[model samples]
Target: MKITSQNKLLLPVFCSAFLLSGCWLDSDDDKAVEPVELATSANVRVVHASPDAPTVDIIIGGTPISQKLDLDYQDATAWYAIAPNTYEISVEANLPGDDANVLTFSPALVGSQTYTILAIGSVGQGTLEALVVENTLTPVTAGNVRAQIVHAAPNAPEVDVYVTAPDTLLSAEQPLATLAYKGFTGQVEVPAGDYQIRITPAGSTTVVFDSGTLALAAGSDLLISATQNVVTGSSPVSLVVATGAGSATILDKDTPAEIRAVHAVADAPAVDIIANNALTLFDGAPFKGATSYIEVAAGDYLIDVAADADNSIVVIDDAAITLTAGMRYTAIANNTLALIDLDLIIDTPRKIATAAQVRIFHASQATPNVDIYVTADGEITDVSPAFSDVPYATGALAETGYVQLPAGDYVVTVTPTGTKTEAIETGVLSLAAGEIYTAFAVDGDMEGAAPQLILLDGFVVPQAN
Candidate 1:
């Protein structure tokens, strides 16, 4: 349950007792031998590679190493200096209403060595385990950089990796390495410059992953691990490049961006969404409705929304929206008919094992400013509002990203900025673990009425009080 860390100091004592003859040696024979000193310290880094594991809190020797609700899949911690000894490391899942201890390991660390401790495999399949690889920290030759590859993706098969000049043809080159799941290659040196990385099945020429162009600078030592792509994109694996200072992600160049449309404009009739005036992206979308995510090429397009009854009555005309690769976006139509506008949000739909992420969006043009509360047991008499003076939705994720919540049931209420009289209330929300809940507050169905809630992302709220 706890790790024991200790640093023992050993000082050697030498006795220079040499006499001219053997007579003086007898006086020193009673002295005891000096104790030997062992090497004192080691270095290690922890990585969360288990594709299905929850956000984790790592504890060693009763001390928490990872902050609560912070470390998750595809994340790595900085190197830590630890004394050379055996320590118990515990990984606890941040599940709601219970203690969830996922894995525990006691590793005997050696002095002066460096290690990467990885949590891998699937948690649901009961194959979760730990892998520790000793990293080589020796400096490389001049004008070259040292790199290593680690295969941490559970879903991928044996693969052939190519690291060559940009625009190099795959068929004419030999693979730099072949790796299976959890496999790795020894550290190798390459000339520092721009290069392209591609991966394919061991015996096939079909590429499954591609890093269009990457730079390897001189004097840099890197460890790149192939991991499950849980964040976004079509590729199954993303490369996590770890350096001495920190880590970075390398997404596939072929990954497409995603967009979801939301109909939040109250008093507006059902409409059809068009892209570049050519494609009808969402047809007959009613008020308070939202469309599912759709994939498209990452580029710029002029968006238009016209009446479902007649396409000539365009609600939104020629609104330019730029979509970037490897990102997910939400386009919401809000405000009144005369002042209608678009709110483009870069969505981050993250799933962690320990907690759920709730996105509270304000699209109600009726309320200029309101106080929002997410409370346990629907009680807010003595608690401060979670978000105060929240205006109607605007650009940049509406400038309010997902809020971290421990997995459990709760209530959500909204009222005018300074008063406690609720304009809308969620009776009780049975929120689940690792789920994302989006509750958009919109104008009431009728004029001069209180605001109402529109649920999205499959989260349902009970009737308001």
Candidate 2:
């Protein structure tokens, strides 16, 4: 079926001529008005049916719009319209018990006013048209990625899909270009680097998209296509992961130098540093170019070298040292061995009372100040609601006193005040009426380090009637 997009431009043109006193009036008297109206362009739609299928929401620009008609049968009417021009369309359907399918389309629409109806059953999957107005294929350079929707199934099921950074799981901040297409195929242009290709389809919780990594180089085009998605739970959703091509890597950081020579004891493994995964082994190399350093839990580690040579040497802050939490260290290497500098710190968790004496510990390292807010659900046997404050300072941990709050989902946020240059991090801690929970905030800034959260199980004293 066909749908017509209203022409917003013509209404103003006709009104302007009427006010001008006969510009369009002369033409109107010379010719008869056309009874049949034609569409300037058309938008494609998808008809999907699955008990667990999600409801799709279309977006024009950044505004939320309606869903495509769910034509479960071939004869069901389903279609969309576009006003001849370039547009960015996004389709998303995220709901509980429904598979998540978010896709987009970037097509140049024409002004001929016609219906470009696409049969739904033939292409089982939905179709997203990048309507080319003048029959011209827009030249997409390397390092640029574009999504294309190819509904290959006539009566096939619908799946979920999204374009994001490989391994990182989130979309890249400075992506070359992002547009929507129908199928799982997409093109991304990037400088030479190692990157993971992520594609998540409907019905899957985690990133069931693609697992293969990308090693993109300058002026190179990469194609990604997914066959299926990773299935989870008891539902039958089509989950497909994208596939990667060529030698493209998402370059995050330089490889750490070898630590074998400096290690008087154990050798270090070939270090692969993942973003936000926490601290890793020290290779005894200077961390001069790294954007951020890793923070490992307080412990001992074995260091090794990426490569070893004769009489090679490495330098570090110290020969061997035990480290704690919330610290930064550097590494340096020469010929054969790499040296590492270890920075250690201890972030403490706050203590709170459950009932009367039970306590739970939480890390507030990357938090600024912890605020305790309360709500009561009528389960407490006592009413001791006093609090203490502990302030965090430079080179020292800030301690805030504590306060008692009634049970419920209490929002605890660390609001930094006074010469403090940090953003607040908020959390919801559910206290079981009489149960106790100790929570605090650390520093979200790099200098302050991310806050630590600890939970110590506690119980409340039973009340006597």
Candidate 3:
């Protein structure tokens, strides 16, 4: 929020000028006027260090008041002044071959007063003074231009508003401005001009504005609001402009239809459900949770309900289901058909107390079987009290596999039993109580493994109970 002298007095003067100022004249000449006590002090000096000759940026209050000064190293120090009121002063100096110096100081100045500032070694010192001067400019056209705040996504976190304007609108040096507050509440102030606005959501690829263009005149303002499709409720975006002509536009988008899709596992291969066919739905697209129904122009879809990635007892539970405009559909997974619930569990032979369970899947059928052997008490034996045969130990295996381990450390060797003679080793595995880890062997050599490890230790284990 920048408050300039002209802005504070514009309204009254403009009204008077239009209403004929000559009509208002003081008729009482005998009244005495007491002197008003001055509230501000003056001259403050600031000096900063410049070991090697370098330039410094001087700012008073929130405005840049001076040009960069180049001072010689070992004798590098500069000074600037501001009015004696409490000031927020900032100095930025750069020394070649050394780190830059940025400092802030708040000092109160009285009328016709001076203050000296000394920042040596790295930063130099300076002085400041406030002078008693008569006012010159009258207010009629004082105003500010500000950036509009917008949300990147509906119901999502607010985004930072930005502006890219023609160089003519801004002084060549002051091309950008930063708003003070965070999210929707913050905005930047500028003199009125045509600007390009960009709203970026926090950690997102979606930008609120399709094209960044905004225009404002003196004493006017423009507010920009952005909303998303997934969001249901209402969210408003706002911005504050001190000066200029203004307008506000809310960036809005329609909400997409919410469609719940249930796979009819029992009807797989029997009923031709349009949505159950794989071709109808986009491949590799995330459709978890409720079936995300997008607004369509009106059409039929063939969905492939064939066994999904999750190998439940029933694979491709239902066939194709017809989809229509403004209509809802559900595919059910019944108890009849064996929906392949690829229920998988892996176990190690013994608790090594140092290594973790290492599950292996045959990268290729030609690869060796994934045999997990156990050596209890450091002895390789046919049978032992501490070691037991893992339930899912198979001579050969396919791609996806899961592993379950008790809380401990163990060394579980992963050897491709059918294809590769070489065994790939894993790092030490530390499992907290009931942790389920899944390993995937995509299209790769038996040696290549991109295993996903999910820690389910936070949940209770039914086996133990």
Candidate 4:
């Protein structure tokens, strides 16, 4: 299908290129011509715009034009050349046991033109569709830059965009363009300099998005897109600033920190974690239990552990902790109720492809400096301490850096440093490929409260292919 302009205007003519082994269609006279005599082809690229869709392969006329192409959200393929004709384009899942075509469409292409075939909308939600946009490569005026805005957010409403001087208020400015979902703006030229970009609902003064300050250089051609954000769970939508010739950057609306709470206090009762003495993060968390990581704006927070879910009875007083952006942390309630302390551990989430990462936390006040061993489930006698001389209190020897091990089921045993007798033995812990975990040595109250091993799940960092 032809890409119609927002104003319903026809596109102008541009230069053409070479054709391959397919039929050619002359748009000027509406006539089909032989492929042998035609020398013009179209410059086209495919984009994976569906946020939740799997990486896909592009097929044309039942031929696999792009194979095993794994395009995550917002990924685009390099330009390809094809003879101008009306051809059937299909998208198939790039996964095993599921080679079904997700979508198919026929679009009339013209010779010597440029087009972008975008797979938009959500997968399986019945909104999946492909959009064809013809691109104009006309050079911008000297000392000026060109840009176009694409609205690809599947769940977002129609919006109005503003590009103004840095820190300009959206309420005081007019939108440069108003666009609907999947709609795009025509290439607009602007003076190359620093400017801020904002997006809001159509005809509303409330600002829903903002790009602080961006430096658009002279002669640069940019494609700024609003898309679903898979990272930074704090925001549903984010901006991706891509150039026609270079790399792209995700302008996250807000940087967030991932944090979890752990109850490691041996003798203390279940508690609730309160932040800023007002918000209850966790309720009735039992001893040795760990909560799943939660995302929050990066900053310093006054943290406290209360005896009640309502945070009415205070146990551990306000403890100030600063969490950095894009980092993972665990706030452990350690020591005894008499001491009532907290320890913050920065957990590294980077993933290793061939092995699992394991770290040890010494939370048991009853256990002395110990040596830890990890071996195949039944081969505890064959392996040595992965970590040695780990102390009891929250100090230099209280925790160990992550150590990598082959993925499998393993038996972990803790012993007084230099001894072979196991002070505590974890029955059997399974470490999966590319996973990260923390093993906490908790109070095994021999007198009815047994000392035990607790495992806390950690984040797995994505690996580059």
Best by the TM-score measure: 1
**Model 3, 50-143: lDDT tens per residue?**
2221345556787764433433211112223345577776665543233243567776655643333333222212221211112111221345
By lDDT, the better pick of 3 and 4 is 4
Worst 10 residues of 1 by lDDT: 14-23
lDDT of each candidate versus the true structure: 0.72, 0.29, 0.31, 0.66
- For model 1, how does the per-residue alpha-carbon lDDT over 303-422 read when each residue is reduced to its tens digit? 998899999999789988777666777777888777777777776655654567788877787877888888987778887898998886443223245676776778998888888889
List TM-scores for all candidates, in order: 0.80, 0.19, 0.20, 0.54
Better of 2 and 3 by lDDT: 3
Question: What is the clash count for each candidate, in the order shown?
Answer: 4, 101, 105, 8
Candidate 1 deviant stretches above 4 angstroms: 1-41, 54-69, 92-101, 123-126, 309-312, 375-389, 393-400, 404-408, 417-420, 460-465
Q: Tell me the TM-score of model 4.
A: 0.54
The CA lDDT at 286 in model 2 is 22
Better of 1 and 4 by lDDT: 1
Per-candidate RMSD vs. true structure? 15.3, 25.1, 22.8, 14.6
TM-score of 3: 0.20
Which sections of candidate 2 miss by over 4 Å? 1-37, 49-53, 67-78, 97-101, 113-151, 154-465
Candidate 1 vs candidate 3: which has greater lDDT?
Answer: 1
